[model samples]
Target: MIEDMLRTPAAVQDAERHTAHNYHPLPVVISSAEGAWVTDVDGRRYLDCLAGYSALNFGHRHPALIAAAHAQLDKLTLTSRAFIHDQFADFCRALAALCGKELVLPMNTGAEAVETGIKVARKWGYQVKGVPAGQATIVVAEGNFHGRTTTIVSFSTDDDARADFGPYTPGFKIVPYGDLTALAEAVDETTVAVLLEPIQGEQGVVVPPAGYLPGVRQLCTERNVLFIADEIQSGLGRTGATFACELEGVVPDMYLLGKALGGGIVPVSAVAADADVLGVLRPGQHGSTFGGNPLACAVATEVVRLLATGEFQRRSTELGERLHAGLHALIGKGLVAVRGRGLWAGLDIDPALMSGREACERLMERGVLAKDTHGSTIRLAPPLTITAEEIDHAVAQLAAVLAG
Candidate 1:
């Protein structure tokens, strides 16, 4: 069994040698997955802590979601936006109801949903809010991880992600994350929206300061600017809630959702808002060929259902306490600190003890799997369906690694 894994498969090697080195994944090539674990090409199993950046909130190949996708595929897969399909309205209505919003604009990926949100905010700024065209600005937090679009990265403060990516896209202003003062001062007459993540996941799961979210929401309302929460990485029971904003009892004018919306089967994402905010887009302004396709719509409809039940959210909340407590036990030893919500937590490590990548490598060797973010932080975002025993076991492995 060990020998089989020692032999790198041809497919993995070829892709490594030829593909762009955008990501440095751990050295396990997964062949199948179920629940909270994944089997590698050599049939070795590991508890999945990353969970595709919270994309598998319902876990791998959830039976209900798969059934929906299969049932839809048997009927119709793609009708495109040229015409609607049977599943489209059901999915839209379901998601809209879940979001408690009047409208939904389905898309295929987090980036596209974010892009759609930006467009929607801008159009509303012009058509409704009466902002000047092309002069509209969106205030984004400094450490935000909205998506990897040219425009998204254009405003990024991370040198690695922003350097040489431009000239850069304009019409965006950046302020220090978690700083309400900066956000308050950044707004002007031309500001259309304040686009931000509830938790800065890509920035190593940085949680905002207390009262920050409610304050931002208030600011947007008072300033007549839309509040766009990019919950793509932090939503849908991943943060132990239907949406991360619930922790603060705040609601934004628009929500950007993705990752878990596909139930880990497909890439389905969407933006939700009231008609007054998102109604600016007419029939021809924007769309995608695969957006709201029958297959994705069907799959996403089930995904919303799973999240609606309080089960996933309750599990995440209960497990999150254990996960964080277990991780907190390691702080000031080998770990620097632990910060996150729900099933996702980013642990910062002592620089001299071990880098986050080294810790991840060690964890991988020890039969658990997780990934590093930024430089010295490892993000653990297991599925909400993960068992308590699995969390304890993974924590034990991490404890052993720290002890060493």
Candidate 2:
């Protein structure tokens, strides 16, 4: 009877009945996951091509991260950021070092991190940059998916994310994605920051022009505006680089990092910046109760250490080249086009082919689990720890679906 409770479809039905209908998830229910593979309750195994939206960059239940979580659990878990714990200082310090910055403000999820960044940018605008309080604006790119919070959603260019959500938060300006002149023209005296995804993941893993980031960095510097890179989806080794901005030898003033920061075990995210900019906050200005809990700190610490080795980045780079080549090889033959960087890709299907959702359902029927984004785009972002053999297997499954 207890085993019956473990049935995936039953659990899924219970969830649908109990939870909100915000997400239209796949039918398959993952019972157990490891590395790049997840097993359903029915004992069917599938390669997790999506990698939990790049949160599992270290892979599911990574041994080092899990051990860190277990060890922390035995000691202490949460202190509510009331007085602070032994792990907070070290965690913040590690994140600061990784970000190549002098300060960090920890948060729980990607949305929360984005919110925190927005607040900081606003404050910096008013207090530091001396913009009119309410007139302080943040420039955001169109087609950006920063997070799901109300304030975060206010600036979204997507109608689905914006419609029925207003009256929207004010002080946001939108411009076309990847347009340097548009971004430059949009910045003004009241503008505090220009936030962008170094590589848009949710919006079909959209890669910007080669010089976009570097150009943005230059523009922000010349205009005395902060260049905020929302690395929430594209950072932490997901793009085969430390940060996608690194591809152009540019470093943004502020980094909104999440997803893989907690090593797929817990929700841990943070905003990192240099001292003068982040030093805008004083005591009691902003805080999160569970921002730097011991458990999240421990796991995230392991995540940072793993990233320092460059192993995952190397793996993603090697596998990504093969993947992109394989996918583009199918272009015009099956796939309309392939767009993305590293292991994350966006496959635009031919008009005659099925929609991305339909293709996902078909892939589910096979042994590979991929999630679709826009109507025609199927996103592929497997774990950095996945083997070449698993890569081949996933490609074969995807190619078969394309052929048929």
Candidate 3:
């Protein structure tokens, strides 16, 4: 008891003393992780249900990714886009092929990719679509969580993310999510792009109504507005497919990809689009220093190869059914609603029973690590590599926590 008291507090206090309170992270301080599990500083093991917000879709320290990072570290790390590295072409070509796009502009984070997409769309609006200069408006949906950039958060519905961050950037139209008619009404001659998450991940894994994505695709096609799908959190096997748009048989004009693209190793993000759209940017218009570094490219290339096998997607589909079935059984017991696809889920815990934060804290005490969203919603995005037994274990823990 004395040792337990000493360890957790000291670690927590040291962390708090050094870091800014930008995030109210759970009390557990993870020391190491492997596959679907992580070990805290106290040496207690916990099943990682959040998977770094789907950034670790390949799981912690995957062998192929680690090997790639190590090999590249031994050879070369960065050349800063000024000169090309050997790992650059293959990574770009493979990722572009995976995305089925003519070009890929690599960046360092999801927000950068989103920013890149906006720039490219605006340029395309002026150069190709013949919209007036500096008047290109992009239509976005409500409850969107694209990124926390000054420009990206300009349209945020969340007060916490948006409040006091302005003078906000302009030229974005916000409409209700999953409302096709509102989206249609919002887009006009000045609209350059319609930016959306194919499945809203940060917004409690909310899936859009049936045919909404397809309808959006059709509308974008008919209206000459570029459809930019921000797949940073919903892509790369998180939704049981290469991209969530595939679930609706809809293909957007551009894919903003990140998270798992880095193989849980480094920050890697990119915007994938065909020639006509991406070609609008001349050489110096947009770029990043560490965007396509040698180390990042090597790790992400292996990540692409792993996805090419389709094994992870298959795993997510099969085990996701098992996961949903287990969570669905607990609906009336403690959970109120469950929504998601593949191995991703958002469980709305009965507010009367407990807040999502309290439930997650209890689950942490019982050897499971998950993240809470909003007031009563908790997101579960276990690695695609997780086993059925692990899924059952996590659900059992949830049940135990709720029963108390």
TM-scores of all models? 0.98, 0.97, 0.99
* Candidate achieving higher TM-score, 1 or 2: 1
Ten-residue stretch with the least lDDT total in model 2:
2-11
Q: All candidates' lDDT scores? A: 0.90, 0.89, 0.95
Model 1 clashing residue pairs (backbone):
none
Candidate numbers, best TM-score first, in rank order: 3, 1, 2
Across residues 323-389, which tens digit of lDDT does each residue of candidate 1 receive?
9999999888799889998888999988788889999989988889998877788899998889999
**Taking the tens digit of each residue's C-alpha lDDT, what string does model 2 give over 1-404?**
85566577787898899998887899888789988899987888988998989999878899999999999999999999778789988888888998999999889999998898888899998889899868999999989999887898899887877789988888899999999999999999999999999988888988988888889999999999999999988999888898988877999999999999989988999999998888999889999998989999988988999998999889888999988888888887779889888888999888588899989988998989888887978999999988888888888888899889
Angstrom error at residue 19, model 2: 1.9
Candidates 1 and 2, the one with greater lDDT: 1
Per-residue error (Å), model 3, residue 206: 0.4
Q: Compose the digit string of candidate 3's lDDT tens values, residues 1-404.
A: 66766477788999999988777899988889999999987789999999989999999999999999999999999999999999999999999999999999999999999999999999999999999999999999999999999998899999988999999999999999999999999999999999999889888999999999999999999999999999999999998999999999988999999999999999999999999999988888888999999999999999999999999999999999999999999999999999999999999999999999999999999999999989999999999999999999999999999899
Q: Can you give the lDDT of residue 39 in candidate 2?
A: 94
Model 3 lDDT, residue 230, Cα: 98
Candidate 1, position 360, lDDT: 94
